[model samples]
Target chain A: MGKGHPTAARAFVDNRERAHWHDTALWFVREKRDRQAGSLPEWELLRETASSIKRHAQSQLADYLLQFEHEATANGAVVHWANTTSELNEIVTELLQSVDATDVVKSKSMLTEECHLNEHLAEEGIDVVDTDLGERIVQMRNERPSHIVLPAIHTKKEEVGELFHEQLGTEKGATDPQYLTEAARQHLREKFLNADAAITGVNFAIAETGGIVVCTNEGNADIGVSLPKMHIACMGLEKLIPKLSDLSVFTRLLARSATGQSITTYTSHFHKPRRGGELHIVILNNGRTELRAEPEIRDALHCIRCGACMNTCPVYRRSGGHSYNTTVPGPIGSVLNPSMDPKEHNSLPFACSLCGSCSDVCPVQIPLHHQLLTIRHSVKEAGGLAGSKRLSMRLASMVFKRPWLYKLTAGLGKCAVRLTPRFIKYSRLNVWGKGRELPPTPRGSFRKWYDKNGGSGGR
Target chain B: MTRMEVAVVGRTTSRDLILNKIRAVELPDVSHPLVDGVLTGAIEYADTVGTFVGSAESVGARVHFCDTDSVVDIWHDICEEFGSGKTANVGIRGLNDDDLTDDSPHSASELVVYGTSGILGVAENAAIWVSDRAINHRVSLCLTQHLVLQIDAKSIVNNMHDAYAKLQDVRDDYGVFISGPSKTADIEQSLVIGAHGARTLDIIVVEG
Candidate 1:
C-alpha cells in the first residue's frame, strides 16, 4: 500500500511557515495564468479547439500511431514500442549500451521518472545527469519532483544554497538566486560538454511530417540533443497530434497556461537525426489503454502536463506535491493515479474538496472535480473506500431518507449537545470538530420555528 | 548492431500488442479542432514591428530596430559592447560567415555569436522562426555565448496563426521559435538568464 495522503500531508503541514510559502508561490503562478488568459479575446475558443483535437487523436490513436511510425521512419527515426514502463527502460538501456555510452545527460522527462529509468540505468553502471536546473537540484537531494514544471518548487533558496554548498561546492550561505544559478550553469555546462548521449521528453509528436517538439525555457533539451551522437526521446502515447498545423493551437495555450509566458524561450522541433547520429523514439502505453476504457476519467488523458491545475488547486497548494507520492502529482495525478492501482491509491480521490478551480484553470478543460467525485463512487464499488467515510455516508443516507426521523433526531441531538459535558462533545472521534466547531445550540429546531413563525411568504 | 538486435522484437510483437489493445476500446469519434468551427481569432496589429519589439523586450530580449543603411553599425557596436571574443558572424551584411564553421567552435571560443537572417518574427509573442536553411550549423544557435539575429521588418506577422500560415518558406529538417535567450525560474521562482544556451540575444529588425 502507498503512504496515505492524510499521513503525508500532516508531515508537510507541521511547519506552518513552509506550507504558507508553498501556497503563496503557487498562487502567484495561478494569478499570472489568469492575466494571460484574460488578455486573449479567444482564449476559451482556443481551449475548446485543443481539447477536441486531443479527443479526436485519442479515439483514433491506433491509426495515428501507425501513421506517425511510418512517417517518422521515413524521416529516418527509429521508433520503439513498449507495453510497460520497464519495457521502456529496457529499450533505453539497450540503446545506451549498444552505443557504449556511459555518461548520459537527460532533460526533464517525467515519463522516465514514472518508470524509475534513472535508477535502472544506474544499476546497469551508466551515469546519468539531469541537465535542467530544477531537476538537477532535486536529483542531487535524491528526491522526486514535487511539481512537473517547477521541480524544485518545494525548496527554498536558502535550502538550495545549502544544497549547492554540499553538491556543487558553492559558498556557504550564498542564498542569492542569481549567484546560485550562475554556479549551476558553470557546473552543468561541463556535464553537457562531456555527455556521451542525451535523452528528452516529447511535448508534441506530429504525424504529418514525423516531427517531435520539445519546449523548454532553459534550452537544455536542444543543447543535450545537439551535442550527443545518440539521442533518445521518451513519449507517452498521448503526446501525438494528427498534423503539423495543430501545433499553433497547442503552443499558444501551453506556455500562457503554464508559467504565463507568451511562449517559452526555446520551442525546438527535431524532425531528423543529427549529422551521423541516431534518434530513437520510445512510445509507452503503461496502463493508459486501460484508462481509455474508463469513461468518466478518460478526459484526463487530454492533459498536456502544464501543471496549471496544480497551481490553482487549493488542496494541492496547501498539502504540497510530496503528499500525493506519485510521479505526476496534483489534480491530474489524483485522477490518473487511482486508475493505476485502485486499492493502493484510493486515498487520492478522497484528497479533494470538490472545488472546480482546477477544471476552470485546466487549458484542456478536464472535468477534474467531477472526475474525482465519479472516482469516489468507483472506489466504493471496488471496496477500496475508507471505512469511516463509508460508515458516515451510510448513516447520512439513512438519516436523509426519512424526514420525520431527521426532525426527531435533530431535536434530540440539540438537547443532547447542550446537556453533554464539553469533553465528550469535542472528543477525538469528531474529526469535523478538530479545526472547526458546531454552531451554538438554538432555542428550537428550524422546522418548528419556521412552522410557528408564519405561514405567509413574509413575516 | 546491438540496437538492431533489440529493435526487431520491439517493432513487431510489442507494436501489435499495444495497437490491438487500443483498438479494442470503443470511444466516441470527436470532431477535429479546426473542423469544429472554432476560429483562431486573427489578431491584426497596425504596427507589427512595434508590437514585436515590445513583446520581445518583455521576455528579456533586446530588439534593435534599424534601416538597411545603418544596421551593420549597430551590430558592430553590439559586438564591441558584448566582447571581442570568438564571434561566429553568419550571413550578416558587413560580417563574414567564415567563423561559423570553425572546427569545434563551442569548445574553442569564449563567445560564439551568430548574426543570421531568414528570421520570421511574430508580433503576439516575439517568436523568431529560424531553421537549418538560415545557418548550416544549428548547434551554434545554442552553444553561443551571445547571439545576434536579423529579421526583415516587412516579414513580421501579427500572431502565431499568421506565422504558421507562412512557415513553409523556412521549414526544414529543424526549426525553432526562439523568443529570448535561455532562462530558468526553477530555483524558488527566481528568473535567471543564460541557463544553458546563449546568455544574451539581440535581434536586429532591419527595414529597407
Candidate 2:
C-alpha cells in the first residue's frame, strides 16, 4: 500500500522525527529485554531450547499443519487454506457472508495487516475496528504500524491526544496516560461487546492439543475472542509448534522479549468454541513453503514473533518499520519480504550495516544479518539488482578479480581523492564519511610501505 | 385463481427469465493446495514451564490453613518468621460457609481464607499469574502484592499442557494461571514493575 496519508507516511518513513521516535520505542523494548533476561538465571538456556523447538516445528511444518487442520476441524473450528492474499480475503469474506456479518473487531494481528484484510473487508461494506489501543490509533490515523508491539509509537502523547480529540471528542488537552488509556478502554469495550466477529493473530498453534495460543496485554484479545459470536484466527504457516509442552519456552521468552514482563496479562488458549461461539483458523502458506525450502535462509522461520531482533537492530532502531514498506520489518523483514517478492524487496537486503546485534539478541538465534546477506546474493543471482548498482558492483568485481588492475585502480582513486575540489570533500563512495570525516589515503599503497620498510612493518 | 394468474404472469414476463437466471451456482473448488516438505522440527527448542517454592517466612507470603488447630499454629509461626503476613495477602481453597462454623473454633486473627490456586514465585519486578480456577476469587491473586501460593508441591509441571489438561475437567468457571507480578515497561524503557498490576510475588511452599 502507498501511504494512506501519503504526506504523513512519507514523512514518517524518511523524516528525523519518525526516526527518533522509532529508535526510542525500540530502545524501550530492548531495555525491557535486558530486565527480563536478568530476572531468570536460565535465560540463555531457555533461549537455546526455544530456538531448537522453533527449528523443529519449522522443519516438519507440513506434517504439523496437516495435523493441525485435521484436529482443528475435528474440534469444530472450520479450517481455511489460502495460498495467496487475495484468496485469503475471499475465503474470509465468504465465511463472514455465510453468517451475514456486518461489523468485526480485530486484535493486533500482523498477518491481517500483511494480507491487507481491513481494506478488503471495508470494500465488502463491513466495518473492521482494531481493538488494541496502539493499533486503534494507527487505524484511526490511516497509517500502518511503525513497530509491532507499539504500533503508534511514532506518535507522542500530545499528538495522540490531539488525534483522539479530533476523532473521539475527548477534552481538548487530555494528555494524561491514564485518562487516554481509560478513554480508549471505554471506546474499545463497546466495539468488542457489539461486534459480530473477532479476529486475532496466533502466537503459537499447538499441534498436539489443536489450540491457538494468543498472548496479549490489556486482555484485549481475550475480550475480543470470547465476547464475539465468531472468532477467526489468521496465522502464517510458520507459527505452529509441535507439542503443547513447547509452549513453556515460547511463553516465557515472549513476555521477557516483548515488554520485560514474565508473561502477558492474558495467555488465552482456544481449542473449541463455547456453546454459542464459532471458531475459524485460517492457515496461510503465501511464501512460507518456499521460505522453508531455502536451507541457508530457512532459519528465518524460527522467529518467535518476538520483536527483540527488531529492537536490537541498529538499522531498524534508526529507521521505523514503515520505511521497509512491509508489515513485518527490521532484519527479519529484510529476509522475509524478499522471499515473497525478490524484485520488489531487493532494496531491503542492503538496508542494513551488517551489524550482528539482531542475531545476538534473537531468542531463536536466527542469523538475521547473515540471512540478509544471503538474500542479497540470491537477488543478485536472479538479476534483480538495479542497473546502476549492478554496473558499479560489476566494475569493482572486475578490478578486484585482477590484482594488477586493482593496484592501478587504487592509485587512480587515491590521486582523484587528493585532487578533488574542496566543495567535494569526499567521494560519494564514502558512506561513513557522510556523517564523519574521511581518512586521508596514504601517499602510496601498502605494498610500497612494505617495500620501503623492508617487509619488517611491526615494531 | 392463484395458479392461473401465476402461469399467465410467468408466460408473459422477462422477469421470470431474469429470476430463473439468478439461481445460486455452485462455488468452484478453491481450497489452496497444501505444500510438502515443510520442516517441523529443525529450528528452535525450549521446555515451556517452570516451578519453584518458598516458605511463608522467607519469601514474604502468609499461610492460611483455616483453623486454630496445630497446622494453623505452625503456619502462623512460619508466616511470622518469613515476614509473609507483613507482605502478603493469603487464602485457603474450597472453604464454604459450612466449613467455618463456631464449632470449628477458628482463631480471631485468622484472616479471610479464600481459595487456593497454586504456589507462585514472584520476581522482585512484581509480575505474577495465578490460575483463576485454582483460587476461589480471581482477586485473591490479582489484588495482593506478595502472594504466597500454598499448594501440593507435586502439582507443578514443566509446560502448559499439564495445566490445560487439568483445566479441561473443570471448564464451567474462571481460572487464572499467574506467572509473576503484573508489570508493564512500555513507557520509554522505564521498567516500572508495578504499573497497574501486582507488585511482588512470593510462593510459600508447604512441604507436606
lDDT per residue, candidate 2, A48-144, as tens digits?
7777777766545556776887778787888766666776787678778768888998988999998999999999998999977778888988999
Docking model 1 quality class: medium
Q: For model 1, how does the per-residue alpha-carbon lDDT over A170-249 read when each residue is reduced to its tens digit?
A: 99999998899889888988888888899999999988777899999998998888777888999999999987778888
Off by more than 4 A, model 2: A1-14, A38-41, A404-412, A425-437, A440-459, B1-176, B179-208
TM-score (C-alpha) between model 1 and the true structure:
0.95
Which candidate leads the pack in lDDT?
Answer: 1
Q: Quick one: RMSD of model 2?
A: 10.8
Q: Give the residue spans of candidate 1 off by over 4 A.
A: A412-422, A437-459, B1-7, B35-38, B102-109, B168-170
Ten contiguous residues minimizing lDDT sum, candidate 2 chain B? B100-109
Candidate 1 at A443: error in angstroms? 6.2
Best by the TM-score measure: 1
Interface root-mean-square deviation of model 2 in angstroms is 12.7
Q: What tens-digit string does per-residue lDDT give for candidate 2 at B59-132?
A: 22333333223433444454465453422233433322212222211111132222243533332211233444
